[model samples]
Every structure is written in structure tokens, then in C-alpha cells.
Target: MIKIKIISSKETYSVRQPVLRAGKPIESCLFDGDDLETTKHFGLYFDENLVGVVSVFENKSNNFHDEYQMQIRGMAVLEEYQKKGLGNFLINQTEEYAKFQNASLLWFNARETAVAFYEKLNYTIIGSAFEIQNIGIHYVMYKHL
Candidate 1:
């Protein structure tokens, strides 16, 4: 059985480090606003082990004029768990939570490879592709709630 629930920012680092920052240090997973009062992290647990994680921040983008918006960061699922629908499950849960928080939209800097994945989920790409210093190319993707 898969269970999804709110988890601490610290707890999310375990999955985030391994899945999102493989060669980098564990500290790389510690994102800004991760410990903020309004920030929320979701964990996907299969049986008792956490297999996927995503962090959402209550932030408004200049590109979006919406009063309330949320940014998804460090979304990752374990390599072995990739094609099992856990990613979609985590995203659906995040959208529900964002709606509950009164956010009008959700956005994220998705990796270029994941653009099609987000598109399939109804998120549209905005602006040109850009690099994130250490990371490769990424596209800004968003979905209106």
C-alpha cells in the first residue's frame, strides 16, 4: 500500500539527496524556504519506506499575476520506483494541498527532460529554457489551479 503524508523538510532530504542530487553532497538537498512556516513537504511511503518526495513553497512568481501561487522544488522519486505512478500520485497530492492553501496556481523549474512529463499533466511551459548553474537546462512550467 502507498501512503502519502506531510513530512518535515529534514525528512525530505533523504529521498531528495539520493534521487535529485546523486553526486552532490546531502546538503545540496537543503533548498531555500524549506524550513519556512508556510512551506510543506510531501512524502510517498510504500509500506514503511519513503520512496518519493516533493516540497512546495508559498511563493508568487512575477511571471504570474495570481495573488497566490506555489512553487514545487526538489521533486524526485527513487530510481527503482520511477515508472510506478508514484510521481503522479505525489503531484496530485501536492495540487490538492495547494488548492486547500488557496493557491491559484503552481509552478516549477522542471528539467528539460521532464518537460513532456509535466505537459502530460496539463502544465504549460513558459519562457525559454535556461540553465541553473550546476544543473543543465530547465524550463519554467506551471499549471493554474
Candidate 2:
């Protein structure tokens, strides 16, 4: 059975380390606001095993005008779980949660490779591409809620 639900910040490290942080140190999986009161960590479970994760922070980006905005960070699914609609499920669930919280916009810095995936969900690029050290090219993407 597959399930999606809110998870603790620590619960996300297992998937984040292997998928998002890759060869980097485990400490790299610890995002800046992972423990913040306003942040929420979500997990995708497969037959009782954690296989995917995404985190959202109540962060505002100057590029957008929405008073209530949430930034998505550390969205990842294990290599074995990719292309199985698990990512879509995770993201859709997160969007619903964000709407419930009164967030009018959702944004994130998406890696070049995953830009297409995000585009499929109606997220559009906001500005020119940029590079994040050790993370290659990225584009700032956002969607109005």
C-alpha cells in the first residue's frame, strides 16, 4: 500500500540523503528550516517503507507578490521509485496542504532535470537559470494557487 502523510524532519533525512544530497555528507540533508515551527515535512510510504519526501517552508521570495507563499525544498524520491507517479502524488498532496494553510503561491528552485516534471504540474519558470554550487543548473519556478 502507498501512503502520503506529514512526517517529522528526521524522517525525511533517510530519503533526502540518498536522493537529494547524494554523495554529499549526511549533514547536507539537514535543510536550514527543517525544524522550524512553520515548516512541514511530508513523506511517501510504500508498504510501510519510506520512499519519498518533500519539505515546505513558509518562505517568501521577492520575485512574487503573494502575501502568503510557501517554498518547496528537498523534494526527492529514491531512484528506484522514480517515474512511478510517486512524485506526482507527493507534490499534489503537498499542494493541497499548502492551500489549506492559505498559501496563495508555491515556489522552488528546480534542478534542470526536474523542470519538465514540475512543468507538467503547471509550475512555470520565473527567471533565468542559475547554478547552485554542487547542484548544477536550476530555475526558479512558481505556481499561483
Candidate with the greatest lDDT versus the true structure: 2
Q: Candidate 1: where is the Cα deviation over 4 Å?
A: none
3, model 2: CA deviation in Å?
Answer: 0.6
How well does each candidate superpose onto the true structure, as a TM-score?
A: 0.97, 0.98
lDDT of 1 by residue, 38-127 (tens): 999999999989999999999888889999999999899999999888899999999999999989999999999888878989999999
Q: What lDDT tens digits, residue by residue, belong to model 2 across residues 16-42?
A: 999888889988989898999999999
Residue 25 in candidate 2 has what lDDT? 93
Q: Which ten residues in a row have the lowest lDDT in candidate 2?
A: 19-28
Steric clash pairs (candidate 2): none
lDDT of 1 at 64: 91
RMSD of each: 0.7, 0.7
Output the worst ten-in-a-row residue range by lDDT, candidate 1.
13-22
**Candidate 1 residue-wise lDDT at 18:** 82
